[model samples]
Target: MALLAYRDKHILSAQQLRKLSEHKYSCFSASLLDPLLQPWWNWLVSQTPLWLAPNLITIVGLILNVVTTLILICYSPNGVEAPPRWTCLLCALGLFIYQSLDSIDGKQARRTNTSSPLGELFDHGCDSISTVFVALSACISCQLGHYPNWLFFQCFCAIALFYCAHWQTYVSGTMRFGRIDVTEAQFSIIAIHLVSAALGPEIWLTKIPIVGLSWNYTILVFITFGYTLNIINFLKMFTEGGSGKNGSSVAVSIASTSRNNEAKNNYETCMKT
Candidate 1:
């Protein structure tokens, strides 16, 4: 009972609950691969039994993804050492499974007539955590930990971009995805894992012909460039503000503030009485 009370007091305010109840999910994805994978996702979701809950599917995928990645981490905690070749393959398969399951959960929810804001919240929460593991696992697969600074930057850059993606959504009332977005990144990481599994992690150390930089460093440069563009795009959206009146962002914060003020006023009136 105490734990429940504590959760009620700290987890969310009355104003937040109201906002959450009123919230609707809006997103735009220009991902190059989404349409390509739509048929597969549809078929997979169709095979899912009506009794299966979407949240359960999401959690199962997240668990598989994290567990498989953890197996690789156990072998190469520093990300510099290559785990067993088979672990890389396993990690790749885990990510693919996670991606597929994550994509279809919403479809299953809709199919079962159980779609809700809570489900979206749960899905995004899992994705955020999965992003960290995915990025770290990719770095290990590429043996980026050999360059400690690059490894740090790569992992943190992926995280920062992910945060900015949600922040942009908060400020604009819409989640936006560029042409080369999450799907492309996920597939790229899977390919990296496959290459490592096939040719060994040392393959990333091979120097490119004229550029002279190792394959790992060359790939890092390309990824950094992509991140830079994503940052620029996010900044542009923030500057443009939201679609709301007076170019306001989502009104949740504003509404919460107003409610707090009202509550304070009411309290003062009660004290005077």
Candidate 2:
């Protein structure tokens, strides 16, 4: 109960705040969702059906991501103008769903004693795969809306840099990713939604008497920032390899086992089915 109220005002729950404290990272939608997610996470853990099932939710998210990609691809190459509002809205919805499910499985595991080595590997592996889905969809959507091809390349740069930086962070340490500090990655994806939202005449930024200026520069400004952030993170790890590490987060490999034992012991003490 206290945790719920604390989370309401704090922006991130204790787990997330602790994660960031450990890893110290940021991203857009990730920051926003930090507050709303914990309650759902706690609830998921409390439920037997929803407890730490990695393959199920991960696949669901993957499929939705694919659906979003396909929608964008359908629009790509044609450069059609004034695509329906519903199309843009639908894509936004897909992205929203993606964010909601992103961190739940891990939370579920920790809370419910479902954590395991196989689960960790599956979750991390799928995260890498999902990055591809975002880039492909963004490129296709822009093309379909008659947007610039450059946008897709910008997306590519951001994703590539992030991908490299993530692996680099792990390599510099114990080859592990933190659950809480995932804000940076999610915000990176949010950059896509922000830029993709720009579709019409007002999309321009500047007005020169002879030359017209538009918001692309503003949008590009965000793109540049995202890329820069990736570079900075990569460099930090490249130079120092992130705090020399106590060790790899190898404990998480046995997290599931730990949880199961705890649950069993609790049941024995309680004598309840």
Candidate 3:
């Protein structure tokens, strides 16, 4: 077939493929707490059947998010109805499931020795899309939707922060998840869900008066913290000369060195096996 011929013509060479895989793995800059959670994650990954592909796990997470999106749409219905209190519980549970699955897929790949460039691309792409689901859920949970501006701002800030973090990774060869990574973000959103269920959605809508502003939004304060961390990271990168003429080589060197260490560890572990 013509399609088969085109695919064959564009297939990557072995060297190119290896470099691509290395690049994919190098893009991750984990959170400080990742190690604290690693044991638990390793256990979870060990429990996963080898027959289950990493990409399948990723799809399961995406499906959970889609279900959550539908539930939000039904409960909010064009934002005309304040979602019932129980909706918060549903969203929290969905996010928990999605986050857990998301965390496990990479481990699954490593365990199976099935890691690939495509898997990394698929994982990041899914995470980016899930950001929207989490954003809308946050707006619904906090009842911030009542104020359109706040709702829009919350969604925009969440997605923008995610983008900026990855962009930093791409340019600086380090994706700093900081003390607060996507996992922490998920936990915080879950907390918001519980608070909304307990105190009612309008609770976060209450604004405290600030000196310069008529009122300060709680969600705004939360987002400001996220932005501040990213700004600090950008400054650190700038100071390191990662922003200079040698940026590309430096970034590649950083990624290569990290990957080399990881590969060495993996090889040693395999020999022990």
lDDT of 1 at 185: 95
lDDT of each: 0.91, 0.56, 0.75
Error of 1 at 209 (Å): 1.8
Prediction 3 global C-alpha lDDT: 0.75
- lDDT score of model 1? 0.91
- Model 3: which residue pairs collide? none
Instruction: Name the lDDT value of residue 28 in candidate 1.
Output: 95
lDDT of 2 at 203: 37
Instruction: Tell me the spans in candidate 1 whose CA falls farther than 4 Å from its real position.
Output: 1-8, 11-15, 252-273
Expressed as tens digits, the lDDT of each residue in 82-181 for candidate 3 is 6777777777888878888999998899889999878888999999999988888877776655678767777887788778766676666555566667
- CA RMSD per model (angstroms): 3.7, 14.4, 8.3
Judged by TM-score, which candidate is best? 1
Report the error of model 3 at residue 14, Å.
8.1
Q: Order of all candidates by TM-score, from best down to worst?
A: 1, 3, 2
Candidate 1 vs 3: which has more lDDT: 1
TM-scores, all candidates, are 0.89, 0.60, 0.76
Question: What lDDT tens digits, residue by residue, belong to model 1 across residues 83-154?
Answer: 899999999999999999999999999999888889898999999999999999999999898999989899
Where model 3 places Cα greater than 4 Å from the true spot, the runs are 1-18, 21-24, 27-32, 78-80, 206-216, 235-245, 249-273
